[model samples]
Target: MNLEARKIEFVQEFLKLQSEEAISRLEKILRNEKKMSENRLVEPMTQDELNNRIDQLESDFQNNRFKSSAELLAKYE
Candidate 1:
Protein backbone atom coordinates (compact mmCIF):
# COMPACT_ATOMS: atom_id res chain seq x y z
CA MET A 1 0.00 0.00 0.00
CA ASN A 2 0.95 3.66 -0.28
CA LEU A 3 2.37 5.78 2.57
CA GLU A 4 -0.97 7.26 3.63
CA ALA A 5 -2.65 3.88 3.63
CA ARG A 6 0.20 2.34 5.63
CA LYS A 7 0.03 5.16 8.18
CA ILE A 8 -3.72 4.75 8.59
CA GLU A 9 -3.34 1.01 9.06
CA PHE A 10 -0.59 1.55 11.59
CA VAL A 11 -2.76 3.99 13.51
CA GLN A 12 -5.60 1.49 13.54
CA GLU A 13 -3.32 -1.17 14.95
CA PHE A 14 -1.93 1.26 17.49
CA LEU A 15 -5.40 2.15 18.70
CA LYS A 16 -6.04 -1.50 19.58
CA LEU A 17 -2.93 -1.71 21.80
CA GLN A 18 -3.74 -2.66 25.42
CA SER A 19 -0.32 -2.78 27.04
CA GLU A 20 0.97 0.41 28.61
CA GLU A 21 4.56 -0.71 28.18
CA ALA A 22 4.04 -1.32 24.46
CA ILE A 23 2.47 2.15 24.07
CA SER A 24 5.36 3.74 25.92
CA ARG A 25 7.85 1.92 23.67
CA LEU A 26 6.00 3.07 20.55
CA GLU A 27 5.97 6.65 21.87
CA LYS A 28 9.71 6.51 22.46
CA ILE A 29 10.29 5.11 18.97
CA LEU A 30 8.17 7.88 17.44
CA ARG A 31 10.07 10.55 19.40
CA ASN A 32 13.46 9.15 18.31
CA GLU A 33 12.36 8.90 14.67
CA LYS A 34 11.12 12.51 14.75
CA LYS A 35 14.43 13.70 16.28
CA MET A 36 16.42 11.84 13.62
CA SER A 37 14.33 13.37 10.83
CA GLU A 38 14.79 16.87 12.29
CA ASN A 39 18.55 16.38 12.47
CA ARG A 40 18.63 15.28 8.81
CA LEU A 41 16.79 18.45 7.73
CA VAL A 42 19.85 20.67 8.27
CA GLU A 43 21.28 21.73 4.87
CA PRO A 44 25.00 22.22 4.28
CA MET A 45 26.27 25.79 3.73
CA THR A 46 27.25 26.67 0.13
CA GLN A 47 30.70 27.99 -0.80
CA ASP A 48 29.44 31.56 -1.17
CA GLU A 49 27.69 31.37 2.19
CA LEU A 50 30.85 30.02 3.79
CA ASN A 51 32.93 32.80 2.24
CA ASN A 52 30.51 35.42 3.50
CA ARG A 53 30.71 33.95 6.98
CA ILE A 54 34.50 34.03 6.88
CA ASP A 55 34.45 37.67 5.78
CA GLN A 56 32.09 38.54 8.61
CA LEU A 57 34.36 36.78 11.10
CA GLU A 58 37.39 38.70 9.79
CA SER A 59 35.52 41.97 10.09
CA ASP A 60 34.47 41.17 13.62
CA PHE A 61 38.06 40.32 14.57
CA GLN A 62 39.44 43.54 12.98
CA ASN A 63 36.87 45.61 14.87
CA ASN A 64 37.63 43.87 18.18
CA ARG A 65 34.01 42.76 18.42
CA PHE A 66 34.81 39.43 19.98
CA LYS A 67 35.60 38.07 23.41
CA SER A 68 38.76 36.29 24.47
CA SER A 69 38.81 32.59 25.45
CA ALA A 70 39.47 33.53 29.09
CA GLU A 71 36.57 36.01 29.08
CA LEU A 72 34.21 33.40 27.63
CA LEU A 73 35.31 30.75 30.11
CA ALA A 74 34.94 33.16 33.01
CA LYS A 75 31.23 33.68 32.12
CA TYR A 76 30.47 30.02 32.82
CA GLU A 77 32.34 29.91 36.05
Candidate 2:
Protein backbone atom coordinates (compact mmCIF):
# COMPACT_ATOMS: atom_id res chain seq x y z
CA MET A 1 0.00 0.00 0.00
CA ASN A 2 0.97 3.67 -0.35
CA LEU A 3 2.32 5.81 2.50
CA GLU A 4 -1.01 7.51 3.14
CA ALA A 5 -2.86 4.19 3.18
CA ARG A 6 -0.31 2.68 5.51
CA LYS A 7 -0.63 5.69 7.83
CA ILE A 8 -4.43 5.36 7.86
CA GLU A 9 -4.17 1.63 8.58
CA PHE A 10 -1.71 2.34 11.38
CA VAL A 11 -4.07 4.88 12.93
CA GLN A 12 -6.94 2.39 12.75
CA GLU A 13 -4.85 -0.26 14.48
CA PHE A 14 -3.55 2.27 16.99
CA LEU A 15 -7.08 3.27 17.97
CA LYS A 16 -7.90 -0.38 18.80
CA LEU A 17 -5.01 -0.45 21.31
CA GLN A 18 -6.21 -1.60 24.75
CA SER A 19 -3.08 -1.26 26.87
CA GLU A 20 -2.59 2.10 28.65
CA GLU A 21 1.17 1.54 28.83
CA ALA A 22 1.32 0.84 25.11
CA ILE A 23 -0.64 3.99 24.39
CA SER A 24 1.58 6.07 26.64
CA ARG A 25 4.69 4.71 24.94
CA LEU A 26 3.27 5.46 21.51
CA GLU A 27 2.34 9.01 22.62
CA LYS A 28 5.87 9.65 23.84
CA ILE A 29 7.35 8.26 20.61
CA LEU A 30 5.07 10.44 18.50
CA ARG A 31 5.93 13.55 20.54
CA ASN A 32 9.66 12.95 20.30
CA GLU A 33 9.47 12.19 16.58
CA LYS A 34 7.51 15.41 16.04
CA LYS A 35 10.03 17.43 18.06
CA MET A 36 12.91 15.93 16.11
CA SER A 37 11.27 16.76 12.78
CA GLU A 38 10.69 20.38 13.91
CA ASN A 39 14.30 20.81 14.98
CA ARG A 40 15.47 19.35 11.64
CA LEU A 41 13.63 22.11 9.73
CA VAL A 42 15.83 24.89 11.10
CA GLU A 43 19.11 25.50 9.23
CA PRO A 44 22.14 25.84 11.51
CA MET A 45 23.46 29.38 11.92
CA THR A 46 27.20 30.20 12.10
CA GLN A 47 28.65 31.73 15.29
CA ASP A 48 29.23 35.13 13.61
CA GLU A 49 25.67 35.16 12.21
CA LEU A 50 24.36 34.20 15.64
CA ASN A 51 26.27 37.00 17.33
CA ASN A 52 25.04 39.55 14.76
CA ARG A 53 21.43 38.45 15.28
CA ILE A 54 21.89 38.81 19.04
CA ASP A 55 23.40 42.26 18.59
CA GLN A 56 20.48 43.33 16.40
CA LEU A 57 18.03 42.09 19.02
CA GLU A 58 19.80 44.07 21.75
CA SER A 59 19.72 47.19 19.60
CA ASP A 60 16.04 46.68 18.93
CA PHE A 61 15.38 46.31 22.66
CA GLN A 62 17.32 49.47 23.44
CA ASN A 63 15.21 51.37 20.92
CA ASN A 64 11.95 50.01 22.41
CA ARG A 65 11.35 48.01 19.19
CA PHE A 66 11.17 44.58 20.77
CA LYS A 67 8.23 42.81 22.41
CA SER A 68 8.58 40.63 25.50
CA SER A 69 8.02 36.88 25.01
CA ALA A 70 4.89 37.08 27.15
CA GLU A 71 3.57 39.97 25.08
CA LEU A 72 4.26 38.09 21.82
CA LEU A 73 2.45 34.97 23.15
CA ALA A 74 -0.47 36.95 24.55
CA LYS A 75 -1.32 38.26 21.08
CA TYR A 76 -1.82 34.71 19.77
CA GLU A 77 -4.13 33.72 22.61
Candidate 3:
Protein backbone atom coordinates (compact mmCIF):
# COMPACT_ATOMS: atom_id res chain seq x y z
CA MET A 1 0.00 0.00 0.00
CA ASN A 2 1.01 3.62 -0.52
CA LEU A 3 1.99 5.87 2.40
CA GLU A 4 -1.41 7.62 2.56
CA ALA A 5 -3.27 4.30 2.31
CA ARG A 6 -1.08 2.85 5.07
CA LYS A 7 -1.76 5.85 7.25
CA ILE A 8 -5.51 5.49 6.74
CA GLU A 9 -5.34 1.76 7.51
CA PHE A 10 -3.32 2.50 10.63
CA VAL A 11 -5.88 5.08 11.78
CA GLN A 12 -8.76 2.67 11.09
CA GLU A 13 -7.04 -0.10 13.05
CA PHE A 14 -6.22 2.34 15.82
CA LEU A 15 -9.85 3.39 16.09
CA LYS A 16 -10.98 -0.23 16.20
CA LEU A 17 -8.73 -1.01 19.21
CA GLN A 18 -10.76 1.33 21.48
CA SER A 19 -9.03 0.29 24.72
CA GLU A 20 -7.28 2.60 27.25
CA GLU A 21 -4.03 0.61 27.02
CA ALA A 22 -4.09 0.75 23.21
CA ILE A 23 -4.79 4.48 23.26
CA SER A 24 -1.89 5.02 25.68
CA ARG A 25 0.45 3.03 23.43
CA LEU A 26 -0.68 5.04 20.39
CA GLU A 27 -0.06 8.27 22.32
CA LYS A 28 3.47 7.11 23.25
CA ILE A 29 4.12 6.12 19.61
CA LEU A 30 2.94 9.54 18.40
CA ARG A 31 5.10 11.31 21.00
CA ASN A 32 8.17 9.28 20.01
CA GLU A 33 7.45 9.98 16.33
CA LYS A 34 7.20 13.72 17.10
CA LYS A 35 10.50 13.63 19.08
CA MET A 36 12.19 11.73 16.25
CA SER A 37 10.91 14.31 13.74
CA GLU A 38 12.23 17.12 15.96
CA ASN A 39 15.61 15.37 16.38
CA ARG A 40 16.32 16.07 12.69
CA LEU A 41 15.67 19.80 13.22
CA VAL A 42 18.47 22.35 12.96
CA GLU A 43 19.25 24.94 15.61
CA PRO A 44 18.99 28.67 14.85
CA MET A 45 22.09 30.88 14.44
CA THR A 46 24.38 31.02 17.51
CA GLN A 47 24.54 33.96 19.94
CA ASP A 48 27.91 35.00 18.47
CA GLU A 49 26.42 35.18 14.97
CA LEU A 50 23.51 37.27 16.27
CA ASN A 51 25.88 39.62 18.17
CA ASN A 52 28.07 40.06 15.08
CA ARG A 53 25.00 40.96 13.00
CA ILE A 54 23.89 43.50 15.61
CA ASP A 55 27.38 45.01 15.71
CA GLN A 56 27.40 45.35 11.90
CA LEU A 57 23.99 47.05 12.08
CA GLU A 58 25.24 49.45 14.76
CA SER A 59 28.34 50.31 12.68
CA ASP A 60 26.17 51.04 9.65
CA PHE A 61 23.83 53.22 11.71
CA GLN A 62 26.72 55.20 13.20
CA ASN A 63 28.14 55.89 9.73
CA ASN A 64 24.68 56.84 8.39
CA ARG A 65 24.97 53.94 5.95
CA PHE A 66 21.36 52.94 6.71
CA LYS A 67 18.29 54.89 5.70
CA SER A 68 15.56 55.96 8.16
CA SER A 69 12.15 54.21 7.93
CA ALA A 70 10.60 57.37 6.44
CA GLU A 71 13.29 57.62 3.79
CA LEU A 72 12.76 53.97 2.81
CA LEU A 73 8.95 54.44 2.53
CA ALA A 74 9.46 57.59 0.46
CA LYS A 75 11.28 55.46 -2.17
CA TYR A 76 8.20 53.25 -2.59
CA GLU A 77 5.78 56.17 -3.14
Candidate 4:
Protein backbone atom coordinates (compact mmCIF):
# COMPACT_ATOMS: atom_id res chain seq x y z
CA MET A 1 0.00 0.00 0.00
CA ASN A 2 0.97 3.64 -0.49
CA LEU A 3 1.97 5.93 2.40
CA GLU A 4 -1.47 7.58 2.73
CA ALA A 5 -3.20 4.21 2.80
CA ARG A 6 -0.76 2.87 5.37
CA LYS A 7 -1.25 5.95 7.54
CA ILE A 8 -5.04 5.58 7.37
CA GLU A 9 -4.77 1.92 8.31
CA PHE A 10 -2.46 2.75 11.17
CA VAL A 11 -4.84 5.44 12.45
CA GLN A 12 -7.78 3.08 12.27
CA GLU A 13 -5.84 0.52 14.32
CA PHE A 14 -4.64 3.20 16.71
CA LEU A 15 -8.21 4.37 17.35
CA LYS A 16 -9.07 0.86 18.50
CA LEU A 17 -6.27 0.79 21.10
CA GLN A 18 -7.62 -0.14 24.53
CA SER A 19 -4.41 -0.23 26.57
CA GLU A 20 -2.92 2.89 28.12
CA GLU A 21 0.57 1.41 28.04
CA ALA A 22 0.31 0.74 24.29
CA ILE A 23 -0.82 4.29 23.65
CA SER A 24 1.98 5.71 25.77
CA ARG A 25 4.55 3.59 23.99
CA LEU A 26 3.24 4.75 20.62
CA GLU A 27 3.38 8.37 21.75
CA LYS A 28 6.96 8.02 22.91
CA ILE A 29 7.96 6.33 19.69
CA LEU A 30 6.27 9.05 17.67
CA ARG A 31 7.99 11.79 19.64
CA ASN A 32 11.43 10.17 19.34
CA GLU A 33 10.95 9.59 15.60
CA LYS A 34 9.91 13.21 15.11
CA LYS A 35 12.94 14.46 17.00
CA MET A 36 15.27 12.19 15.08
CA SER A 37 13.83 13.33 11.76
CA GLU A 38 14.20 16.98 12.74
CA ASN A 39 17.79 16.43 13.86
CA ARG A 40 18.57 14.75 10.57
CA LEU A 41 17.16 17.70 8.61
CA VAL A 42 18.91 20.46 10.59
CA GLU A 43 22.62 21.28 10.51
CA PRO A 44 24.73 23.84 12.36
CA MET A 45 25.42 26.99 10.31
CA THR A 46 29.04 27.96 9.69
CA GLN A 47 30.30 31.26 11.14
CA ASP A 48 30.66 32.83 7.69
CA GLU A 49 27.16 31.73 6.71
CA LEU A 50 25.78 33.16 9.96
CA ASN A 51 27.57 36.51 9.39
CA ASN A 52 26.23 36.70 5.81
CA ARG A 53 22.69 36.09 7.02
CA ILE A 54 23.08 38.81 9.68
CA ASP A 55 24.41 41.27 7.08
CA GLN A 56 21.54 40.52 4.73
CA LEU A 57 19.02 41.02 7.55
CA GLU A 58 20.61 44.33 8.47
CA SER A 59 20.47 45.45 4.84
CA ASP A 60 16.81 44.49 4.62
CA PHE A 61 16.01 46.39 7.81
CA GLN A 62 17.88 49.48 6.59
CA ASN A 63 15.95 49.33 3.30
CA ASN A 64 12.57 48.98 5.11
CA ARG A 65 11.88 45.59 3.53
CA PHE A 66 10.00 44.28 6.53
CA LYS A 67 6.66 44.97 8.13
CA SER A 68 6.17 46.37 11.64
CA SER A 69 4.83 44.26 14.52
CA ALA A 70 1.55 46.18 14.48
CA GLU A 71 1.19 45.67 10.74
CA LEU A 72 1.74 41.90 11.11
CA LEU A 73 -0.72 41.67 14.00
CA ALA A 74 -3.29 43.68 12.07
CA LYS A 75 -2.91 41.43 9.03
CA TYR A 76 -3.51 38.32 11.16
CA GLU A 77 -6.37 39.86 13.05
For each candidate, the alpha-carbon lDDT, in order, equals: 0.99, 0.97, 0.92, 0.99
Quick one: best lDDT, which candidate?
Answer: 1
The number of the candidate with the highest TM-score is 2
lDDT of 1 by residue, 37-69 (tens): 999999999999999999999999999999999
Poorly placed runs, candidate 4 (over 4 Å): 47-77
lDDT of 3 at 20: 98
Cα error, residue 35 of model 1, in Å, equals 0.5
Candidate 3 Cα errors over 4 Å, as ranges: 44-77
Backbone clashes in model 4, listed as residue pairs: none
lDDT of 4 by residue, 6-72 (tens): 9999999999999999999999999999999999999899999999999999999999999999999
CA lDDT for candidate 3: 0.92
Q: Distance from true position, residue 1, model 4, in Å?
A: 0.4
**For residue 70, what is the lDDT in candidate 2?**
100
Which pairs of residues collide in candidate 2? none
User: In terms of TM-score, how similar is model 4 to the real structure?
Assistant: 0.58
- The residue pairs found clashing in candidate 1 are none
Q: Where does model 2 exceed 4 Å of error?
A: 53-77
TM-score of each: 0.58, 0.62, 0.53, 0.58
lDDT value for candidate 4?
A: 0.99
Candidate 2 lDDT over residue span 1-77, tens digit each? 99999999999999999999999999999999999999999999999999999999999989999788999999999
